[model samples]
Target: MLKRTISMTAAGAALVVAAVAGCGSNVQPIQVKLAAAEVLTQAARKTAQVTSYTVDAVVNVKHPQQGGGKMQGRMVYQSQPQLAADLTLDTVDMAGRSLPGGARAVLQGDTLYVKVSALQDLLGSSKPWIKVPLTEQGGSTEVRQLLDQIQRFDLGNMTQLVTASQDVKAVGTESVNGEDATHYSGTFPVDVAVQQLPADRQEQARKGLAEMEDVAFDIWVAADGLPRKLAMNGSKQGATLDATLLFKDFNKAVSIEAPPADQVGELPQSAPTN
Candidate 1:
């Protein structure tokens, strides 16, 4: 059942990043925020490469009909770019009466190999867990997407999502988690669009574009041009998702390899048609 959830989660999760964060009023100032964002962009560019990342993600599952559940887990992701990554879900644990036990998935290239127990299988049996082929899914994955999104830091790209039209003012500098950091804030542009669809489908949209409105990020970039921390909060449909990411120990070689023969299960190379 957990495996099925992961599969289902993958689909819903595709737009999860869009669903988080909000823009608070006069929170900090425009210049402060823009500068912080610029700093983060510079840090990302300066970094030699990010081979792997350790993520402690706490996922809250909610449905209009069903209440909600929270699950948290630590993941070590290794990537070799166009290749595959050895993603390990460690300390896998979750709680929430309706949710299942821990979950795991081995995603190589475009294939997301999920394993679920028979009992859990019954939970999502009626729902679609897998997705269209990777070729069809387009360019969207935790690691891969960052490469493009980070470029938006040029203020031009950042403005498209947040208070871009308004002036960005920089607040005074302060210490965040022991690192000297700068703060910023601004008014959101009345019209800003956040990318919520898969890259390929993003161009074919209209209403309900993702709730990236009135949102701002507290980005912490190291003096050396590396992102050390980020805080984002936003609201939509009467719901809010706040996320914070702190990067450290950024010294592993980026590497991804095809799944070992033993780990590669029997999966059809193509999706079935009606």
Candidate 2:
């Protein structure tokens, strides 16, 4: 159930970003006032060409029924040669509760290693790591699902949020990670964003977000024409979401190792969902 909880949270964040597909706020717009999508699309293309990168991301979700929490972490991702990632969950608090000292996860090849407090009692051992073999699910690595549907909000996917905007504008200039970049901002109405979704997804989006508010988005692209940062915010009848991604070290080598075998345990038939 922990998997499903993380998935649900990720889905909530996705719905907000995809639902917002827009940007606007403190960052003022300049005279350029170009269509934001142009910049976003260019940035997306440049980023996609890279084989790997490091991302510092944070997502916050607030819901009346499901409650809310803050999830922030630094992750290294590799797309060339193979798919791999290593990340630490700095915080995973929900409804005023949280995991003990947070959690950490690593995905190398088809194996995933997760280190969290929940594993201690469930496995009836003191080993800090629990190992699980991953398999391809549909088009994504199961690791992505295991780690809060991470692929859904990666830089590549985050950039796609712009395509749903109908009035995005070049806001101004800003420095991201010390690089000067163009800032884009705009807002998309709730109904309009849903219309932009695939027919198969439109219905689901409508029903799931029937009470959601419009999302605002902001994108900063460096002079090199790559995204420096991306952010989105929105709210539903009982939930509010705010997410931001900062990208850097494109195509950098990332090293990750599994925990020592003796320090790890095989996942039991029933994993802790709470």
Kindly list the per-residue Cα lDDT of model 1 for residues 94-132, writing each as its tens digit.
223323443444445555544333223443333222221
Candidate 2 lDDT, 1-274, residue by residue in tens:
5654444333433333332221111222222334567766655555546667777778787778767777776777665465667777677676666666666777677777777775455457678887766653432232344443333234443455455677888778888878888888887666776665446655545433434568788888776666778787778676786778787776567676677889887766455655
TM-score of each: 0.54, 0.76
Give the winner by TM-score: 2
Cα-based lDDT at residue 238, candidate 2: 64
- Candidate 1 whole-model C-alpha lDDT, 0 to 1: 0.38
Model 2 stretches astray by more than 4 angstroms: 1-35, 136-144, 151-153, 189-213, 271-274
Model 1, C-alpha of 57: deviation from truth (Å): 3.3
Query: Quick one: RMSD of model 2?
Result: 6.3
